[model samples]
Target: MEPLRTVTVRALSGRVGTVGSGDGGVRMTQLNGKPVQLKEEADEPGWEVDPDDDWGIAVVETVGRQLKLRREAVGMRAADFGLAVGYGEDLVYKIESGKRIPRPEYLDKADKVLDAGGLLSAMKEDVKKVRYPKNVREIAKLEAQAVELGVYVGLSLHGLLQTPEHARALFEARQPPYSEEEVERLVAARMARKAVFDKSPVPALSFVQEEAALRRRIGGTMVRRRQLEHLLGVARLRNVTFQVMPTESGAHPGVDGKIELLKFADGTAVGRSDGAFNGRPTTEPKELRILELRYSTIRAEALTPGESLAFIEQLLGET
Candidate 1:
């Protein structure tokens, strides 16, 4: 593949112009025998594209190529294009080189500035499909395939059981605060993982949540009320079980933190913990045994499935 040349493009009164590097003149190129202005400079930083992510890479590269072509077709400098699109020059260069993922609004502005006739903005849908961080997708995949899923949550509701409003509240409360678009995307992905509940041969699902998690009031009173009601409904599923460890249970094995186990019909399993294993998912049998033991003990100590439902109902009444 030929190396990408760095071209200084400037958007001038809605038209693109190229400034020559060596001489105080402009250089032009031809597209289908029609003369067009383009200039060459040093290459920008190269992005280390992930080889495992073919779809994501393809979408980004396509958008980048289209943006570059449109800018060049009209003779716009990257800096000038950035100015028109409400971004910095370096960001414009990164976005055009496929090193940065442009936000949807960025594409909208670029479409208008470059006079793309909606061509550039149309890429937003493709980009949105791959916008989620890769790790979340992997976890969602595991949840979708498991024959049995066990979870012990200490702080917040498990993603699989979160109501849309509750999940949105959690995402909105992140430290840096996700953009409105990002909050919507994350909530949608989280909700999609709930497909496990609707799968044929319905997976056996067990949840052990600390009492604190139930009473934390994640999304304030109204959201929390709906979330509790949602939990009561989920607990009624024949294949699902819910257990709540009372706050007075006092320093149990689960005090170490959250734990998760997923078992498949083929006897393959994976486990994760926020305690000893440092929170990374593991498939090793030894790690799986330890996680299973801890989870089993926590579930045994928690309130029985029927009692847990009553507890949630009581909490709902208090709301």
Candidate 2:
């Protein structure tokens, strides 16, 4: 096995000191009379709290108070606690003061360090939802409960089917451009929506993509090849039905734009069409009926599931 790497912090005019090789996690090493943590991985996320998410804000604040209370109860100062938990003192204060969202891994470390018997770690579920954008969480919640989902995208691969590299490339190409952190966050959220495919009893997922979308090569050769390969795999899933709307079969109902319809086990459904009803998702039976009709027509015009998989495989070979 490779040796564990160590980090030295503020060693100005001072010799290094101390040791403890943790379970391949952040290890404590003393230097310059200050406690330091060794590098482990890219910095954990969930640093910033969404300003518009009131419920998420409240959850973060509650978790922060718990962390603060537990640390204080054990008579550990902020700096001491930070050293023990493998983070900076200021970061600890920020999380405790409700100025930042704490990452799930951090909670696990805190739970062990504070002897909370999994209480701190258990808070991960609550904090997990807060880490994502408000709109994303709302969408994810709907997808999680949906029993049937139908999506049509004329321009790009739907979020649930996109590879991380493809999604990152798309995000990076936006006009205003997203920061590295925001790109990572959005990608993570998109990936989480895929959990719908893994839900117990599994949701029946149906996706329709334009032929041009498959041939566009969005994320360069290797990335696009991987995406096409992934699409083939997903297409083959028993519960998933994928189709491609060939360009040659023009003048289709999908020409208006994207369509998304999600039906629940309770018989309730929500649908949205870019060209209809101002593009707002609606639960009204009439609106949903219209969207469903258009979707059914589009699906009828698109290539069959078997043909779609063959089409994607050909694209992969071309790459």
Which one is best on lDDT?
A: 2
lDDT of 2 by residue, 1-319 (tens): 2222222222122222335465444445575577666333245442566666799889989999988888876767776666666676667888888877887788998887777777889998778777567777877777888999999999989999998899889988997987777777777667766867888999999999999999997878999988988898899999999999999997989898999999999999999889999988899988888899999999999999989988888888789
For model 1, give the 10-residue run with minimal summed lDDT. 39-48
lDDT of 1 at 287: 89
Q: Write the per-residue lDDT of candidate 1 for residues 1-319, one digit (tens) a residue.
A: 2333344444343333454676465544333445554322212111223335677778888888888888877778776676566555566776778766667788998888777777788888666545545667677767878999999999988888899899999988999987766676567667656878889999999999999989997878999999999999999999999999999988888887889899998989999999968888899999899999999999999999999999999999999
Q: Could you give me the TM-score of model 2 versus the true structure?
A: 0.75
For all predictions, the C-alpha RMSD in Å is 12.9, 8.5
TM-score of each: 0.62, 0.75
- Badly placed stretches (over 4 Å) of model 1 are 1-54, 57-132
